[model samples]
Target: MEVDGSKGNMAESPTNSQQTVSDDDEIDYSVKPEFYDPKLDDKDELWVQKRRKGYTSDAVLSCPACFTTLCLECQRHEKYVTQYRAIFVINCKIDSDQVLKQNGPKLIKGKSRREASSVGGETLKKVSCSACSTEVGVVDEDEVYHFFNALPSES
Candidate 1:
């Protein structure tokens, strides 16, 4: 068996230089494109209306505990790494039944995006729970729509 000059048995071992070389060969995920355009624009009309009307939907849902109004908007994720969980559940309250009746609930549906600026065209309010800082709901011109109770808390 071969041994080092110090008489200790020496076995072939990976060096820091070899590890560095292997790491350099690894794929660079940061250079990959992350966003893809939505395949369909089925809600185009509703979306336009919501933006033009400033989310003036008349849909209303009240909190049984506080009687406070609520509404919702989808917020995109902050990082580009994982966009699947990008859409955030936002809340506020508004009052505009005429808009809701005219456009329908389908317009309220949100699509995830890669940009935070593009999230919530106009319907999404910036209201938060005055009590817990939790986003309670959002409102349009006529009423408020509360968030889904089953949704996990946004940390």
Candidate 2:
């Protein structure tokens, strides 16, 4: 019987180049570092409102009537007029299920855009607390509702 040494040896031995290629193909499924921002702690309502006059993106807002926590602090964003504009508007993205619809005339006549532009008409519908029927926020044309009558959950 002829001994088949070559086949067995090749299977057992991995060349340096092959080993490096295998190592390079390894994938890391770990979560991203930026997913959790350390700076969010400093952007809460207490800090932003005291200095800037309103909530920041890191403020936990809740329904004022029932005190139900509708949205977390991380869901908020500051709308500014310009890079150095004096006007600042803080808006929070609240879920639709958390609010009750109120009867009001349509605020905008056009579709909502993902990003605000000069062409798109800004629409806003009045919304209230689902649990207490208290006026809470306005549903924008983007379908993202804001907590206009919300207070800090911690307060």
Candidate 3:
């Protein structure tokens, strides 16, 4: 019950000699825990990906006339869209069956003015709105797409 004033009123920390290290509890000094961004790493696979691959809200591309959902455009399909002549060519698998359904004489493919530029040398047809018979875009002979919907510029 006696209070000893021998030690000073200060906190004492253990010296290096007093510190302990174990083989199993090894510390990695080379690598540190950090927030990793794939775009910043040269060796990362995404590093080779588009530097200007713009981030856009997930969009549903539709027929400009009837507003029928033609395709779902996102960052994944954005990479496949390329420039062909004066129009942008969509060379990815979109929802073609529902968008380009045949009813009576209504086929998605109308005669296109675009040259014979296709994936397999097949003739490309202008994509028409199945509901409104409006020329929306173009498609290939394989029933796959090379869609040419020009997004209206915002003013």
Q: Rate the local accuracy (lDDT) of all candidates.
A: 0.37, 0.49, 0.43
- Candidate 1 vs candidate 3: the TM-score winner is 3
TM-score of each: 0.20, 0.34, 0.30
Better model by lDDT: candidate 1 vs candidate 3? 3
lDDT of 1: 0.37
The parts of candidate 3 lying over 4 Å away from their true place are 1-58, 73-120, 150-155
Off by more than 4 A, model 1 = 1-6, 15-25, 28-52, 56-155
The 10-residue segment of model 2 with minimum total lDDT is 80-89
Using TM-score as the measure, the top candidate is 2
Candidate 2 differs from the real structure by a C-alpha RMSD in angstroms, to one decimal, of 15.1
The reply for model 2, stretches above 4 Å from the true place, is 1-57, 73-120
- Which consecutive 10 residues in model 1 have the weakest lDDT in total? 81-90
Pairs in clash, predicted candidate 3: 127-137
For 1-155, candidate 1 gives per-residue lDDT tens digits of 35677768686677777668565578586775467446436566465456435543223333334544332233323453222121222233222221221133333433322232244344443334443445443444333333432132221
